[model samples]
Target: MQFLFADCVLDEERRELTRASQAVSVGPQVFDLLLYLVQNRDRVVSKDHMIESVWGGRIVSESTLTSHINAVRKAIGDSGEEQLLVRTVPRKGFRFVADVSEAQNPERLSTDASILSLEATKPSIAVLPFQNLSGDPDQAYFADGVVEEIITALSRVRWLFVIARNSSFTYRDRDVDLKQVGRELGVGYVLEGSLRKVGDLVRITGQLIDASTGTHLWAERFEGQLENIFALQDEISASVVGAIAPQVELAEIERAKRNPTRCATAYDCYLRGLAQMHRGDEEAIGEAITFFKRTIEIDVESASAHAMAAWCYFWRKVNGWSTDLDKDESEGLRMAQRAVELGRDDAVALTRGGHALAHFTRDLDTGIALLDRAIFLNPNLASAWFLGGFLRTWHGECESAIEHFERAMRLSPVDPELYRMQGGIAMAHLFAGRIEEASVWAERSYRNLPSFLMVVALLASTRALSGRQEDARRAIEDVQRLNPSLRVSNIADWLPISRPEHIAVFADGLRKAGLAE
Candidate 1:
């Protein structure tokens, strides 16, 4: 018998596997494993069944079995990350997820792999129901509610594909292997946790795992009073989603980078762009723009890509790295507008594009409206919250701006852009006439990113306003080095302070700190 699939031919009588007419040097066990998977392509082959059939019921260590599976995949140009052909079924078994046909001279007919491919080949996750460890049956509902809320929260992430609760709950109370769950549910990551209730206090523990690799990427514990069960549910859900999103994003970026460039997809290019964007340096931002441009070329309607590309220009402008200011502004606004037009429901696109509009067009009202809509779409999105806070600060909504910044910090406490959030809080304080608070936050932000122009300016302004002459002078020196062209006279052009009084506050500090008018 002979089977042909994905340019590889498996011959049973001669016991040979050939690719592009060249024979593959597979070991006996690997050959048998491949043959068994191909023969059972109509269904998943359980690990036990595979061991019994291939290893003759002998005891085989997990590492040995994994090695054999890897060998088979390598022989056929498949990888664990890609899972293009051989797929792992979490808590289930393995399946050959490829099309196969019998050779003309074959004695047996070929069965097509029954499992269909994922509709969207993006990063996907499944959230299982949290176990109730409280020793009370009534606590199950609360645990279930937390899982449902997490699923709902994760669904709001436009870039993530989350499994529905109905499908995920099917494995309730099942002691399933994480890798098996990944294969069965066809997800890259899995979130599992437990909840415990004691008197008026509740404790929840959660862990995020790379299902394919069975690697625990993140784990944390949350404790809160259960005075209001629903409120506690909301808090835990937000915290879990906020912590897991960044980890999953980082894992996806690394996976995309691992794939060969020759086979890079639009999603892969976008992920690479995001990776570069997080570096937040001049050269890295330029490379990020290039990757985003490539993504746009491949997928012109990619709203998030357009928004990110626009924001790259905004970053360059704010950091004083743009070599062509007019070109950057024009191109940035064009992309930002297009992103808003295309992605009315995408929070990330709306957040980045709206900030660009606020910075480049000075349409603060329109920008704030877009950001508010984004928050409505995904309330847990930290970027939307922080960027909205920034616009509010420029628009003289000092108290409201501080609230938004605080909310963003709560959402993503260890965010990569923590310094930006800190800077926003400082600016709000400076505008609200809280010099001591502004100085503390600005100094903390400066320590994280010394070259951040706004933070440096804030430090100088707050120090000068608080009568710290020498410290203010040092901050002014750092500011001058970061942006040599900046002066007190042209502060309005640099920052769009809507109120004349707010501009006066910023300028007075700079003037006091020896910035020439």
Candidate 2:
């Protein structure tokens, strides 16, 4: 495979790079780095991804990495400052920003084996960080906050493929090309705007561009008071997406907007909590809980805050991150119950709190109902679909669970919760008694998140049941390394499988893998 951009050609088969038909001198590391970036050009590549792919997870110094990046830039007739082709996303690593066209065998192009294609299947748009035109610099946060609100609002539209913020924000503080930005993020439309705040008034100017032809689809300027920021965000998002896909049902966007808080400060706190929560580690989740609690203190009726807080505790209980399991479970149930009681109309709150209540309290019926209502209320809510799928797996409805899981995947193809979704697919297959299919899904999930003990257990069970004794034993060792104590009689204490047959299948597999009964 070869990539052509600007006056350069990068040939992967020959392991060569050229600028203006002249061979460029580059080390093996630099060549590998460039190839990785080009193949993953559809999204921002993280530093961890670079290390894992280029260095084989070996320890490499920061300065050395930066130096290699510079070398790659130079060879491609680009510079770190200009970033014409290679752009560094602060703290997020780098992206190949140039427009690249593939020149390769069609079969090889389709089966790169290294990259997951982000082809747009739905009407998609990326709202890049709104420029802070206020010149105060202090209003940078406000501008970014508005952009995030717009992104969140757009994400709720099921027919829209909204690029995640991290990928869009990679081009921040740089001279942007709308066509190039669209190509890099795999979106059809791009929204670039500026925000200016003065005293108690604010003005937002936005222009929507068709990246395919660099055509201006829509342009608008919104003027409103500081307190009316949320309303402006909703209007801007609705107008932008409405222009792109006129078929986008406005009712779904309205469903998502119903939970917006009256107090911006409380909303800010909730956003901060969310930022911390997405980190997916124990310590970050704890801090996220603190911020969420603060949001609730400011507005006791904040259903989203209550729901997020419940989810934090629920995560702690499930991931074995808490020292006092009983105490945490009790607290989590209380918060989740309150959230469900107050958030009957809010999809976000219902989805999060509903899953927490159902998963932790074993109230499968009510939990699944809440998730069902959430999906009906907002079909675009990917998490709701995924969580609902998991609950269905527990209810022994494998086919229905698989449908919802596929819907979730179609909505958010590159979802950060991909591991959780894959786990749901594994369980769905397990419930259907397809041991081989179950093993394939479980192994994929475990590879994405090795720390997930449940996926490791599934990998062991499926392999053992498929008569792959040696591979099963290796997976069993992983499960034991994650948790030493294991016995068939006590298996229910760890896994949530309720059906006797399903439990027996796992137990028998584990026993076959040399675990004691």
Candidate 3:
């Protein structure tokens, strides 16, 4: 389908958005949203309607919807106030108001078909839930965690569009044809795998297939001692990504490599903990903590596990699920420090450890150095880039922070925790004295995750600073409702920024946003 607006044309089948005969950069989701809006130009689409139509009714917050809206506007040189191309009718919803005309592009369709016929045209891939070949059903979590990691690792490549785990796992244990699966899911490639663990040895087998003709693109068997499972997974993922997207840079391929674990069981426990962490509830966090602790108990030298456990505690404190902030903060800082001391060669451990140190301990210089080293080791480490961005923003390096945040977004385009990156961007904009841009990013951050206290607070303050009094008040009310115990006295202490000016800006924004003492 071809959509023409102004001088730009979006060809959905070709997966290309062009302006003045030149291709422009538009992320996958933004492209999808644009295609939907232009295709249904005559309608007033509500948020629910758009979510159902665009996101296939997946569970996403209002913040996600707003981010897409902002993306679309940014693409078209439009804004909330201008509403030149897309108009928002308040509570009712949105409409595409531009003079758009459908264009017939036989050449574009032919080009798309030609590209589709190519061996690499298999644009879609699904990472099926790995079979728990282990005897104990309790190990199901381990197998599931492996599949989840593969999904996450693969999703980091911007060139590949991965089906979310929730959607892909629907085929679990179902006998289905690859061709039919491809047609149903609208993907050209499918990946299926199995995991078996016995004693201290593990075996993993995976195959990548062209869904069109059921032709194997690549297949490999990974066998290693249980202690090296993490390394084995990384090797398989890096190999697969390299095979599918040959254009991916060498630096990124190395970044895709997973750090080796000191013990296999510790890796297993860490994976289990990760699976539980996704639930984002107090009970889940507790379970995750237990798993992490078990991993550490099994292998105290497992730096990655220790750092991840510290991260869990950090979140528990932030979410108000833990009453003992002092204990949580102290333990998190200790584990992070120990992780760094033990795993100097491990980028993942270093990133998490640095983040904990920077946020919990307020050690800016040491934390920034650690994070920078982590990024240098693995440029594809999205979390490292994210933490680096936050640290840089607080250190008054707004441009550098934006660069890091943009890199993070590119690496993890569909990250479930995208609000964190957006919040970083908002903070950078605010610190750079771009009030309007700050307001935009702050709104986008809040739109992607309403329950994100940091984003809510940032948005409230940005709005107030921008002179949007009512909007600021609304944001403040939302934050107060979300955290009834919130008070001005404790905010500065809780905030991760180290610089006085950064703290002052945040506190001032909150004060102006009408936060009660």
Candidate 4:
């Protein structure tokens, strides 16, 4: 489709923007934003509405938006002062004032005969639940997590259509033909894998096939010790993403490659630790820490193990699970630093280390830079985006923080840690003075994970700030129930923010929400 605005034309099919028949440079995201605006030019689009449509519901900085707007203007030979084509209304939102006309491309709209025939006949692909070859049936969570992670990784590439995990996992334990599976799942590709574990050694084999032709597109064998199970998983995920979307950067692919230790025993322990870490309870956290420590004991150079151990300690400090905060903080910082030093090339390791540094050492800029590098290396890494969001929020760039959080949420759509992302959104809205919007998001966060005390606190504060006294009081009560010794003064210590005004806004909200003096 061709979108004509002023003297420029955007060819959606070619993914190119042009001015007077000459090509103009524009990033994919900027192009998308411009297209969306032009398409919806009839009315004013709110920031939230634009975020959902353009960024795929990921939160981005106001500055980032401004930069894109500037780029769009420059490409169309307009300026902020001119406001000739696109206009930003203060306190409201953006509007596209340009006269736009849509030109159709008949060839571009033509459907593949095979695809059409299949649509009348059957759907295309099915993602089978990976078989847990780990003798311990309890290790099912690890196998399940792998499939989920793969589903998430594959969904990020715009060209590939993926079946949701819920729909894909429905065929668990059922055997079916690849062609039939494809028809059932409505996808052209089928991915099947098996996980096998014997003591410390784990071997995973995966194959990708074009269901329509019943041809194998790619296949690989990943063999590693349990100590490097996480690394192996990362590698497998990256390989699958690369095979499915060849346009992905070579640097990103290399960054996604995994090099786990040759020691099978340590690898097994590490996989066990990974499973426990996903549980995210105090007992599970302790068990994960023990297993990670054991992995490190067997392999002192295991950067992943140290990074996970530090993450567990950081979690403990955040959740008030550890009595010795100073000791935990010191150990977490040291381990995170060591992990970064040893695993600078590892995206996951870098993200964990960056998060630890940001939270424990208050090194916001350094931490953000590390996470950004990690994202550059692996754009599909959800944890890196999550860490970026958290750091940006702490640094008081609420708008940008929201964008990172939204991207992370999109990357891990079915992740159980969704509450964290929702809370991030709520915080951003709270800081932006959209109290009602913050309350709505806070409520969503609470509904998703009721035990999240921080979300409960934020919900109460939002309600109070919005002048809903009764609801605020109830939320405050919920907070007190979760943390019996809660008080207002200690909030500043628990909450991470660089600006006093930000803290003041939070405090005022909480106070109005009926927080204890």
Candidate 5:
């Protein structure tokens, strides 16, 4: 059925809307709300009725409903003030006030609504309830909460379609075929996991599968002490989403790669860059930067791409791979500033751009503030927490820095950058005068990545402070091997240590460890 009103046609068959012969981009929820309003044009549908029909009776905030309503009006070229079509009936609900005529058949091709309704051609997934292996009713409740949190986090990814918890939970405790679940849920992928509790520790295992093919895409296990149940749940949610997001994107990228004739879009270029960046090698990072640059050229307002390009430069500087430090730093700073300017509310942009700005400009406060805003926007973003921890460590917030690092580590336990977070913890411990703990973490970080200059330096300092002369000497040798130019006198120039006391302590340790003054 097609509804025509005020130069706009809403095609129910295609799940599309066109205004003045031009396609109007509308979100699924917004489109559903508009259709519901038009179908009940003769009556003022109450909020309860709208929620039941449009949102499947899920609990929605007033702001969310209002925003969808506003989007519906904007799509139809109407407004709250004018109320030319959709009108708010005060305490009642909404009514489509315009004349609507329906047509049984249209000339346009009738595409499958299954593909069209799934985020307008994007891939969609449903996260099934994790089985409670402990057989305890309380554990089952906890598992449900974990799934709910995972769904909430996945919803933040703009490119993916997430089935609502209510819909996904309908398969709870039911043994169903993966392909059947896919067809029933109208999704391409499904995530199922199991939760088990042992003593004061909880273990959660999750696996992502291609529902249509019954092929496993990714799987991982997370275990942590239940010191604080709520915090643990948050951590598991972050880790699950963080791991799953990249796997899903990589799967999509591979799918796109398989289609040799498909033209590359800005998003395709961005995804390719993301895959390269995750490789974390000098040459791969350089290639990632090129891909991101191509993305920017294709879409000039690609804030995340710009931020990633700047971050690649920062990565080069950190690893001493910059052939021309001055040129790279300037270019990186420009992109970082541009990213923050264009992406005030974008969490990824703010996190990467803020960290790059902090590194290139040495403006620790601004960088910390921007990262804090990113955390506020997306608390599950592990990079924001860990990177913010770095700035906080330099800013002399020792305890707070440690908490951030721990939280980040928990959020992505298997993250390739785990070494970085380990090094951050060592730095924080060293600053707090915990030599033994610092040495332990520094050694762990050095074992993970021996070439990491900061870890080597921290190891030398902590070993020297702990009165281990021979071990400190070996670490000092490794540090000089990594960066021969680094000296006790130039500690401040090497790192952004803003606190005089922290600087004094770090330099004193390096001096005792045999670095030249």
Candidate 6:
């Protein structure tokens, strides 16, 4: 008989256990203990019964039995804390509480909804159940939790559409075809992973695949101590998202950090604010400002809070959402300076605060230096590269600007701000006098973010410079539609340009496209 629960299968006839199609290794005593439990899952098995049946009636000490049981738990991915499959009935014997499916034949089976085929508009992904390789069947809970956390993290990204857990879990019972899963789930990508727990350590393996062509995009393995399992989960989730995004890399900056104040609620509030900040909209920025301020009220020494709040103000300035430029910029500069001072060693805090400083003060040299330090601190930070690239373009380093923008794009191709990266590329081309290429790239950027005034302006300028008069005129209409008060005379103030020639080149397009002088 073959018994299956979660992603693990135990074959009694073969005296074997496999997870995710991989053979698991367990000691003979632990194997017998697990098998006896599954075979008699309907009833509890006492210590005396286990000793007699599995140990050939040999004399077994309480410590010996406890050690073997613990081994069984370790081998299956279960712990004393999380007893999902194995349950201790007070002073009585142990019982298997999980719902078990038994099959006489060895063939795999799946009852969960199988994917047929559907068209997905944006980058869509499904995180299937991770196979538990802890020879012990109880480890299913650990594997399941890991998948859930990954799904949650990915779903937080506004752009990528994530398949619901129920839909993705349908394939948990059996092997699946990538193409069918893609079609049935209406997704472009599938993320498959496995978990293995051995002694004090655990190893996780994840692979991202293009469902349509069965092409393997990326695969990674992570190993860490069980004590830091939560931290390891964050690392894996961030890495998995980074891989799928094609260089859209971000470090697991949170790293299971509990608030120094020992307040979970306060920490949660801070995190909620971070989610809103990443949305990058005027309304969302305002929402984040409120959240971050509350976090400061709860914990006075929150460097991250100060940094993010500083960024909210800077973003407002760049987008022309600020009502009072003087007051906002002053406060923004102070918050940004505080974040930088406090987060001397924190890459996330430094990156955010440094970007805000660069924009608020227009100090290109200082901004670029701080961002460079941020990258040195955490090489996977894509935001730093993208921000620095834009700064470089304004500083008249077009080649370097193009390189940085491309680097950011490669890291996070499916990033929600993908249009911004494309727009930066257009700006670089515009500065370098590659008018036709600039026009093409700008048009693509505008399509992705039609309401973005910067992109609209870019398209207009590039088109006019490239002799695409009609296209340029349409771009002007779009930009003016968003902000009719914008005029060529003041357009230079909106652009973060330092070099006179670069500003002139950009303004020429807007002027030619019929903006008011």
Task: Kindly indicate the candidate among 2 and 6 with the higher lDDT.
Answer: 2
- The residue-by-residue lDDT of candidate 1 on 1-517, one tens digit each, is 7899998999887576888887665545688999999999999999999999987887777876897788788889899999999999998989999999987454322111101122123688999988899999999999999999999999999888899999999989999998888877878889999999899889999999988789999999999998899999999999999889988888988887777762255677888899888878788899999998887765555788899999999988888788898999999999898788657778999999999988999889999999999999998999999999999999999999999999999888887788999999999999999999999999888888787888899888889999998999999998888888889988888877899999999899988998888
For each candidate, what TM-score against the reference? 0.77, 0.51, 0.51, 0.52, 0.68, 0.53
How big is the positional error of residue 173 in model 1, measured in Å on the Cα after superposition? Answer: 0.8
Worst 10 residues of 6 by lDDT: 247-256
Q: Write the per-residue lDDT of candidate 2 for residues 1-517, one digit (tens) a residue.
A: 8899999999898576878987554556788988999999999999889989988887766875887788788778899789999998888879998999998833433222211122211356788998988878988877787788778767765435788999999989999888878776766678889988888778888887777568776676777786876676655554443343332222122222343642234545665677667666678889889988887765455677888899999877666677787888888888898788657767878999998898777878888999999876666677888989988888778899999898787665655677888988997898798988899999888888786777878888888889999998998888777666656677776556668887888788888888767
Please tell me which predicted candidate would have the highest TM-score against the true structure.
Answer: 1
Better of 1 and 3 by TM-score: 1
Top lDDT prediction, candidate number? 1
Residue-wise C-alpha lDDT for candidate 3, range 5-78, written one tens digit per residue: 88788887777777777655554567778888888889988888888886677766676588779878877778
Q: What ranking of all candidate models by TM-score puts the best one first?
A: 1, 5, 6, 4, 2, 3
Query: Cα-based RMSD of the predictions, in order?
Result: 14.5, 21.8, 22.1, 20.9, 9.2, 19.4
After superposition, which runs of candidate 1 have C-alpha atoms over 4 Å from their true positions?
Answer: 1-120, 260-263
| C-alpha lDDT of all candidate models, in order | 0.87, 0.76, 0.73, 0.73, 0.85, 0.75
Off by over 4 Å in 6: 1-205, 208-241, 244-264
Q: Looking at model 1, report the run of 10 residues with the lowest lDDT sum.
A: 110-119
Q: Report how far off residue 142 is in candidate 1 (Å).
A: 1.0
Which segments of candidate 2 are over 4 A away from where they belong?
Answer: 1-264
Tell me which of candidates 1 and 2 scores higher on TM-score: 1
lDDT (Cα) of model 6: 0.75
Error of 1 at 391 (Å): 0.7
